[model samples]
Each structure stands twice: as C-alpha cells, then as structure tokens.
Target: MKVIVEGLHSRGHQVSVVRSSDSWYIKETSPFYTSITLDIESGFGENFITTFVAQLLETQREGKSAWTRFKLEMEQAQKASELHENTCKMLEMLFENKEVIQSLHKAKYDLVLTDPAIPGGVILGHYLRLPLVFNVRWTSQGEGHLSIAPSPLSYVPMTGTELSDKMSFLQRLLNVIIFGFTEYQISQYVLPNYVCLIEKYLGPDTDYLSLFQAADLWLMRVDFVFEFPRPTMPNVVYMGGFQCKPAKPLPQHLEEFVQSSGEHGVIIMSLGTLIGELPHDLADEIAAAFAKLPQKVIWRYKGDRPATLGNNTLLVDWMPQSDLLGHPKIKLFVAHGGTNGVQEAIYHGVPILGLPLIFDQRDNLFRIEVRGAGKIIDIFTMNEDTFFQGIQEVLNEPSYKKNMQRLSRLHRDQPMKPLDTALFWIEFVMRHKGAAHLRTESYRLPWYSYHSVDVMLLLVGVVLIILGTFAALIRCLCSIVHADGTFRRKG
Candidate 1:
C-alpha cells in the first residue's frame, strides 16, 4: 500500500524528499522564481507573503471596483513571493515526472493524503484513482469559490462597505472559473495566457471543483468537544484529541514555581509562532490585568521585557506548554486559539480564555464558546478590564472547569488515538484496493449530490404542473357550460 502524503516532511512519511536544489534537470524544468526561492534565500521566512496579502486587503476598500481589486490582490499575493510559486512549480514538476506520471496513469495507490494547499494532490487522485483525504491543519475553507463558511470571503473586509450579503450566483460562478484559471497559471508558475490556455486545455467547462470524489475521507483537525466542523458528511472525521499524549513532567524549578503559588496558582499565556513580538502596550495592559489577581502570571513574551516588572509576573520567551497545562497549580490557560494550544487545554482539563487572531482562530473560538468550554476575547479590544473580566469569569465559573474535564474524557474515550484512526483509515483503503466502491453513493447522486437542489426543483416543478393542469381544466369547463351539464362542445 504505497501512500503518498504531499506537503508533509515528517519522519513518518514513506518517501524521502528529493531536494530541488540537488537535481539539475529537475531544477531546470522548475519555475524560475521558484528555483531562486529554493536556492536558499526566500524559503526561510516566506510567510511574509501572507502578511503582505493581509496588508493589501486595505487598498481593496477604495471603490465600486472592489471585486476587481480583490481579484488583483490574489494575483498580487501569488506574484509576491516564490514560496507559493515554488509550491505550485514543484507540483508541476511532479506532474511531469514520467515515472510518477505513469504510475499515476495506472494508479498503484491505496490512499493519497495531502495538506489543503497541495493542488497536485487533486490531480494525483485523478490519475491514481485513489481515495483522497484532506488533513486540515489550519482554517482552510479553501479558495474563493470553494469556500463554505468561516473562510475569509474577500481579501477586503466585508463589513462597513458596499459589499453585498453574498456574492451573487453569477459572481460565484465567475470566481470558480477564475480560480480554475489561477490554478493552471500557478501550475505553470508564471503568468501566461491563462484564459486561452484554459480554453485550449480545459474547454468551456466552468467548474473549479477538482476531481475530489476520488477521495473518501477528510480528516479535520477538530475535536467534538472543542471544534465542530459542520457535520456535512460522515466521510469527514474530527480527530483532534486522538493522537495526544499526557504531558510529560515539568522541570523541577517550574513545578516548584507553579506549586509554590498555592491557591492563587499561575496564569499561562502564549501567542504562538508567528507573532512573537508582544506590543509594549498590550504587555502593559496584560501586566495590569494580572496585577489585580492573586495568581502568578507566566507570560510567553518573545521580546525585550519592559523595565517595569511585577514580582508575580514572569516573562519567559519559551515555555513548554504541554508541561504548563499539566502543572499542578496552573489555574487558567490564555492562548491565541491555535488547534494544538486549545487541544492541550482540553487535553489537560484546563479552562481557557482565547484571544484569537486571524484565520481559523475566530472559528476555533466560536467552537470553544459553543462548546461552553471557554471564553473569547477580541485581540483588538483586549484591555485590562476585558482581559480581566474574561479570565476572572473563566476562573470563577466552575462549569467551565467541569466542562473541560467532560471533554477530556470524551476525547480520550475514543476507540483509538487520532493518529491511529488516521492510520487505520489509510490502511483500510489499501486492504480494500482503493475503496472506490464507497464513493458509489455520491456518484449515484446527481450534481446536487450534497444539497438535493434537484429534489427541490423537482418538487417545485411537480407543484407547478399540477396547478397548471387544474387551471386549464377549470378554464375549459367554464368555457363549455356554467350551470347546464349539456352544451355545444365548442360554439
């Protein structure tokens, strides 16, 4: 059962990645901008491109052509850097690899899994005829047209603008078509005659939907207790709490520090990977918020500390969070609502106060609140009072603590760990020879497979036909005779 996992470079994978830099001919076939980025300069912190995309969102608010601006912004985003280009170009190279390409033509796969960003995974599933599983690690409602909910709709902020409630059907269709072209351009790793190339290669078929029916599973990084991904299909599995292990023992000093805090315990705060720099004002506000509490604050602030420091507040750039959550006396966990961080909180039965930033953090916090496991604080309005209120509410409310434990049990009670569940599903496909039969029900249904729009239309049409027949009969009867049974058939 040869399974290929794209965009994952963990030791757990089967294929040792061939570095693009080492292969001369492969590098020559590679996208020019992509090769430059892979040459070792742009790959380090290329996430600046996403921030750049975030920044361009402001200009998108200028005028009636906001949609135009939004479209241009997407173009600007891909053009902004080569990390994205290299990602697409690499897929293109793999597509060209005669060996890989031929194997795909005559699919020798049991299962194929990929991160959401790997579009080639879409192409591969088509070639290999394997079950596709999307293991989502972030907030990916997918690209513009494919987005369902909680996806940032437009790069531009929709509120306080002339934006319509939803992009009209025509607009959505256009976006789908546009996204298809964009994907092809991305595959080529440069701007070319996208429309002409798409027309020549793809014809007038205007659907951005990939051949995803080949995939049978979608392993969402969500837990039933914390995040509820829309229960749209049984094929999608939420295994967030599955692979987690109990936290290892904390260092002696840290354990002593937390336990020494007594009934006051300690507050844990970490902002995650990207935004390590704690703004001075937020730091001051946080410090002030904790000043009123009896708890000692362990803030994961990754920067030069302010000159003013309280005796109870500890500013450490690095803290092992798993160990922190398992600490004997940690009262509350204040985090940025990343999946791993939130999972740790629920994993250790610790109550939470989430200050989510962009991406799925909002959706993640919404799930947290919905689950009654935690409270969310908007990062923008996070002052001493708001922060204090949120933390205090969570700490005071015994239900939050109780709920955390309840979820911890449910998460742990599953038949196997999530990793095991994931592994089982992948292997299950191999044992069944690609499990293509499982997708038969979906294929049996028409294009309205998920929604049943066809059913709705059929019902409406039936009603209309019945009404029309009744009306015609009444008209003919009235025309023939009003009060008498006998009359000339037609005068």
Candidate 2:
C-alpha cells in the first residue's frame, strides 16, 4: 500500500489512507497523501489475531499430524468467532463515532482500495458505492477470494501444506479435506459474522458478499517464479517485488560494522513486525549462537536488550532492512520468512536462514528451501548448535548463494518491473471503468459446471440410457424367437 500510494501520489493523484492509530510500524506518509487514523485501543484486536496465529505456529512446532492440526483448527475456529465478535464491537465504536466516519467517507474518492483481510474497508466500499479494488498481500485461495481460474484440488496444495503441484494420492485427498474444511469455516463462521456486523453497523441493505465479488481488480503480491503454475484470471495481476527497490547507501556506522567483518560477511536478523519480543530464554540462546559466529550480527531486538550480546553483535530496535540486504558484505538473512522480507532477500540475492514463526511465513520458508536458496529451522527447535549450524550451512554452501543469485536474475528479468506493472494495471482499470470485461465467466458458474462435473454426469446418464435400451431390445428379440419356435412345433 505504501509503495502503491507513493507511486500514485508521484503521478499527481490524490490518495488517502484510513488506518488504525496503533499500527505496529511507525506512521510514515508523504505530504501529498492524507492519513486518517481510527481512535481506538487497537491492542485487543491485534492481540486476538496474534493469539490465533500463535496457536497455529505452536501446533506446527509440536510436529503434530494433519488430523491433530485439523482438530485444533476446528477448535480455533470457535475462538475466532469470538474474536470476530470483539472486532465487530471495535468497528462498531468507529461507526458510532460519526465524526470519524464522516471524515473517512466525506470526499467522493475515485476508488476504494483495501486489503481483503480488513473488513472495514470492504464495508465502507459497499456503503459508498465506489469502485472497490483488493491489494491482497497473500495467496488468493481462501477467505472467499476464490480465484476465477480453476485450481485443481489434486495438484494445487492447500494454504499451509507446503506441498508442490505434484501430490501423492493421499496428499490430494488430504488437500480436498483441508480445502473443504477451510471453506466450511469461512462460510459457517467468518462470513456470517461479517454480514451481521455490516448489517448492524453499516446499514440493512449493504451486502458485503456482493461487494467482495464486485472487486474490479486483484493485485496479488506474488510472482509466478515463486508460485507453482496455476490458472490465473485476467483481473488478477502479479506484483511480487513491488515493495523491493534499489538499495540506498547505509549509514557510516553500519558500513563500518559490515566492513569490520573482513572476509566474513554480516547477517541481518529480524522477526518481522508481529513478534516484537522473543522469550528471554530464546533470546539468550540466540545471543549465545551469534556470539560464536565470525560474521558480524546486526540483530533487531525489540525486547529488553539481551545481556549476552557479544562484541561482534550489534543490537538495535530497527535497521534499514532492504538497504542492509543489498550490501555486498551481507551473506545471510535470519528472518521470520514474511513475504516482503523473503522477496527483498531474493531481490538482493542474499541466502536465508529462515526461522518461520507464523502465518504465511512457514510456507514462504518452504519455498526458499525447495529452491535451495536457504534452510528452515523451527523456532521452537532452535538451540545454540542448530541455530549456529543453520547459519554456517547457508554461509558456507556456495549452492545457496548461487541459487539465490539465479532467482534474483529471474525476478529482475521481467518485461516490466513490478511497480510499473502494478501502476499499469491500476490505470488500466481506471481508464476502462473497472475493467469488467477482464473478469472470467467462472465466477457466474456453479461449482459442478465450473469443474465440468455436471457435463460428465450428463454423459454418464446418456450412456446408461443407451445401454438400458439395448438390453431391452435384446430381451424382446429372444422372446419373439422362442414364441416363433413354439408356434412351428405346434404346426
């Protein structure tokens, strides 16, 4: 969103962003843009979501089987419903505050752009009757954001399975089960809650389902190189490296730190914006591991400064991540495997030592591992030995760096850059008045029709009818022959 807004504003377009006041990142915006902050204690909602994410991550770390994870997810769904209700209450507070609502919707904006995860924007888009566009920063499989292109259940893995296009028979069956369960949870638990909230807060006639389906464009933040081959819709645009750019020069102290490593390069460590603090024991373990490394460590520690920090390790609350990755002296990235972070590392051709913590991070690490550009170690399973070994493996193995460089080349070898592609699609939708023609007819088709199941059933019915008729004819002919033989015998 920051990149898109900056681009648009640079092109002389007015952009306004409505966001929660308690956003995790520092609030940064251009003077040409407008920012609207919701006045609410944002901690509860974010904490609730984080709790759910934690549950998932813990389950994965436990090495639980699929059935166990599924059962836990079902339980989690119930908790999610409660969280949804609480989130609705928070939104209700905003809706009740007429001053904020008026400020948000007063100007007739040309388009209402939103992330699909955020329902407030979806509701507002419907209420204002504006052209809605989704800038989805994740996979386009679930959350009622069904792809127009038919995703084959047999091959395309479920959201978190980390499987490739090729699947065993059992794997495909599990995929079906997982996909069905996800849809069931969304329809039975999530969507209905959102509908009720919208009706209660927004108005009676506002249909969020329709608004979701009415989206003019879906600018998903993934690329074909990273994703398995799947059918895609015209309305969907891939903008994987939109957040990535040419790196700027690092500050002198940071530069000296990298150069001071001599032959050994520096490693940049971060857990992304969500997990601000690590458990003290884990932090100490990390500190101990970094202490043994020859490479200089630039660690982003959000919690109380670790007492075990060695002379080679530098701790800070934040660092310019992209710029640091682009440095020649940087050899490895120890990160949470968030999409943007992984993409930036790929853009800069830096090998990763991934400790994926939650959500899409696990899947992103799976991709990095499959591509041979990195290694994945469970956060819970990390000890001084394993963590240090993982770092050494990536840094020592030339294959990791070679694969990352190859990927970076492929990522940069596009017809148009990701930002330009995004801008072009955005303007294309604007010029063509929503680009309705780009949408696929699959959206209008029933599930059976979309997958050709109905047609197959019709074919089966016709074959059955022909077989039944042939059997009846043969039976009648045999009976006639017997009757004629009996009549000849009587004569």
Candidate topping lDDT: 2
- lDDT digits (tens) for residues 1-491 of candidate 2: 87888898888888887766666552635585777767765453566656766676556666657776676677667776675565566677877888876866778677887877646667667666677777886322252235445578887777777787889998888889878878788777677767677777667775555556667888888887677777777788889889899999999999888899999889999998767677787888899999998889999988887777789999888899999999999989999999899999999999999998765678888888999999999788778889888888998999999999999999999899899888888877677667678766554556698679999999999999999999999999999999999999999
TM-score of each: 0.68, 0.88
Residue-level error in angstroms, candidate 1, position 237: 2.4
lDDT of 2: 0.79
Specify the poorest-scoring 10-residue window by lDDT in model 1: 31-40
Clashing pairs in 2: none
Model 2 ranges with Cα > 4 A deviation = 20-30, 37-79, 86-106, 139-147, 197-211
Q: After superposition, how far is residue 385 of candidate 1 from its true place, in Å?
A: 4.2
Q: Write the per-residue lDDT of candidate 1 for residues 346-382, one digit (tens) a residue.
A: 8888888988654446555655666688898866656
Every candidate's lDDT:
0.59, 0.79
